[model samples]
Target: MVRTLRTSRASRALRTSCAARPEYDSAPTGGRKSARRRTGTAVGTVLALIAASAAWVVGAAPSADALPNGLALTPPMGWNSWNKFGCNITEQKVESVADYLVSSGLAASGYAYVDIDDCWMAGSRDAAGRLVPDPVKFPDGISGTAAYVHAKGLKLGIYESAGTKTCAGYPGSLGHEQTDANSFASWGVDLLKYDNCNDDGTSAQRRDTTMRDALANNSSGRAILFSLCEWGVDNVWTWGAGVGNMWRTTGDINDSYGSLLSIFHANVKLAQYAGPGGWNDPDMLEVGNGGMSFTEDRSEFSLWAEMAAPLITGNDLPNSSAATASILGNRDVVAVDQDALGKQGVQVSAAGGLDVLAKPLAGGDVSVALFNENSGAATISTTASAVGLPASSSGYSLDNLWSHVKTTTSGAISATVPGHGTVLFRVSTGSATSTGTTHALVGASSGRCLDAYDNETTPGTKIEIWDCNGGANQKVTLTAAGELRLYGGTQCLDATGAATTAGTKVELWNCNGGTNQQWRPNADGTVTGVQSGLCLDVTGGDQPAGNVNGTQLELWNCNGGANQQWRLS
Candidate 1:
């Protein structure tokens, strides 16, 4: 059973906590894969694992190599079977997807696993009581299906429940964990989605444990990629170690930006638990599902990739449009997920609903995810300097992992992303020189960068983006502009600038430019508005109009609130 990450056929899959729950139901598109963690001893019975090394603490994140599984599955990248199009799955759909993955060269690019989520099985079990394939649906049966997939140079995957019925109300693994695991192995199933649905808090652990034990025991000769699908209840981080290849660490993900932000912020602290044989899953990504803006999807993909979460595609493959595939096909971003060392990124800063995350890879290159979780446009800004990098980080090589563009960093860096979008970058740890044409920001023409909002009204108001001509609205500098200027001039972008701090207002009166507008970019990836000095609040508005002169702004602590995001372009 010892092997590399099922993804690479070269390394391994990889591990976290949190109590955030979600409203559970189904609009019929399918269901959300689900989170939490538990404890484990750092010590291990190495005799059993010839292909791996040191054991990981259930809840405690082990240093790089200390993870039970090798760094094989970091940044696991593949297409899911939900989202853009839900469970309207078909055999031909998977085949076509396999075709697309191979013909399109995506499989070689790391989209190796073609997974069939729940419902691929029939409504009835075989006479033996094991779940059966919907022969009418999967005419070739899973084994044939798997053979077909493997023929296309891809691996095959399928889903099951640890309950009496799958999330779709068909057969499950509940009382038949061992039976199902063995059956899956028999069917040539390489990956298993052992879920915890139909099980509440008490039964959740029981379901996960029983299913994991079954999968491990049955996966004797061949390696099986195990994905534990319990919504992070009872702190799965402490209990998930060595339980599966990757386990869900949060509630089901929705098509909304807030949903993604909530999960992403929650995963930062649990970053240490991820590595090789196990990982902390943030549920499946909702990219290309139209549940969120392209920006939000980018944010979703980027952060998850940076966090080394699984790349389980949750939409119907054939039905997935090119845009959806494009999201899944990003190689640079995928590289962060498929990084050799496999480390999940941690949030360095968040405010105005913008998140700054960074993951260290095998080489000196570092993967950074700049996520805009807001419902509207935001100019998310942060510099390598803001993330505790040495001041020498100023001119590091900045490559846009998403756009696939290479540039250089400046004293700081700023990226503008639309609602829900993200900008991912790989920063090389080396000296950089501004070629004027090569820097991502700044030059002889960039002048200065700033965001102006008269956030003196209620929170969640329209946050306006503007050019920093040093006018009254944009004349603020990074220092005490003189004195307190609590919410004045242009609109309220509150003076204090704490990302997670809540409750401040923006007002526009004059531009005496006090500490309210004299804020500095904190090393934690947060921005200080300087005027009124409060962190800029998004006020909960989903999409703000650009250059709106009377935009009302509120202030709050800087926990990456969407309103607090600003770029100096």
Candidate 2:
């Protein structure tokens, strides 16, 4: 069976179960308040600021106010020790990160909660069956580390598996839910990352039980943020809201562009469960964490803002350089993380080499990020008047969040980006009009895809459609080789490319001097079909031949095959 999304509303039936250096009243979440929330059970409504002492079952479905308190975690920024240090995590490390949080000014910038990931525990529990910190690693013990973090003005977080063993094969919570929760709460723990790797894919009983037990242990009214790391079991998002403040919808992330992009694309639409406290976590940010580049790191950070994900950093804080610190210190982008609405943006459309991700911000403004995740350099032109804004966002005009630059984009927001790059913008509108189409398409120019300098690939290459880019597919560059080159990159049109005859396909093939891949557009709207000696044929001559998604194209006996024809409308 296809893997069903475990984050559906139904997944909240599992009951799983921080902080404040502030005189601040809780922030109202969601867009302009609709109605006052009547609190009773897990009321996740906008007005239900604090939760009462009613216990809940893990994944136990709750009312609209299901999110426990104001901790659904909009800006769950903290330091983690997995990606960089791996099993080298020690109490000293956690405590030092807490120190960095306070001293490096990260805590003041809204970065709190220092967490210890896998391997902080000894190989086995004690005779009393309680988890023990490795004497070598912690020296003092789990409680000592939590106390140290608290002294440093940061809350402490710990990790464990819901299964028989933690990811590192250390002692886990498994059947000892009550013991683990009691021990965690007793140790002054503030956050729990209950991973689900070693556990058998058995039933949801374990899920419900462990989560319930944790809630039972948090009787101190100290809201426990349960982070279910079940990797999309039973459409986890649906039931996840009832379980914890945040749950990871996907698996652990690597510090690579491909991995980051894949995870972001796979997870969207669950942003509704996110607010001030409840979050849809896309694992931890692998930014500035050694695995990916600066470009990849920027994109990863940008995506977290778009997804409204928990901004837990899994890198060594003490070792971060100036560049890394700057990437993490973008207060404006982080504001998107704290955008109160907590709505995760999604990939609305794709063309050329650009992609558009939109998240609704607090107040009336909407945050939109236009990212270039392609290889070569690229650009895509989009009219701001067409992007849900009225007159380029009121007083300050258009604001670019990532760069913190402000400009009047009353017409269009055209951006030039390096390959594997991005540009993020927050379009604020008090009374702006939503415009054009649901998703705007980028111009398909002529260029082999290209980097900053020139075409990265061989000239006269095939023309491929990347995320909406203006490189070459948008800009046609007729080549001297009698073949057309997408001005900047590789990818030529394939003439009668498919093996099949009738329901054959047409795509970007090689520019091997083939007729099937040649075409010329006239001064008028008509594009002369040079390849296959026929205009782009709309095989079977059907308009709106979609919904049955596998439709193919063939070079029809051209009676000016309408199906093969497209006029960039």
Which stretches in model 1 have alpha-carbon errors above 4 Å?
A: 1-72, 84-87, 200-202, 319-322, 375-394, 417-419, 431-569
Which one is best on lDDT? 2
Error of 1 at 89 (Å): 2.5
Model 1 residue 133 lDDT?
Answer: 84
For model 2, residues 353-436, the per-residue Cα lDDT tens digits are: 488777766566767777787877577556554555556344324565543334554466566655666677777643232121
lDDT by residue for model 1 (1-569), tens = 01111222111111111111221121111111212111111001001110121111122233433324332344444665644334466787778878867655566666778877766877888889888888877899888888898888888788876655666566767678788888888878777767554433345566677776777678544456777776665676776765666777776677677778777767777987887667889987666556654445556777777888887665544444323444565556666776767577878888876878877766456677777666665777777766545556346777665433345666456676655667777777565422211111100001112324442244433333322223344433222332222233233333333332345554443444445534443322235555444554434422322112223455655544323443221
Clashes of 2: 84
Give the TM-scores of the predictions, in the order they appear.
0.62, 0.63
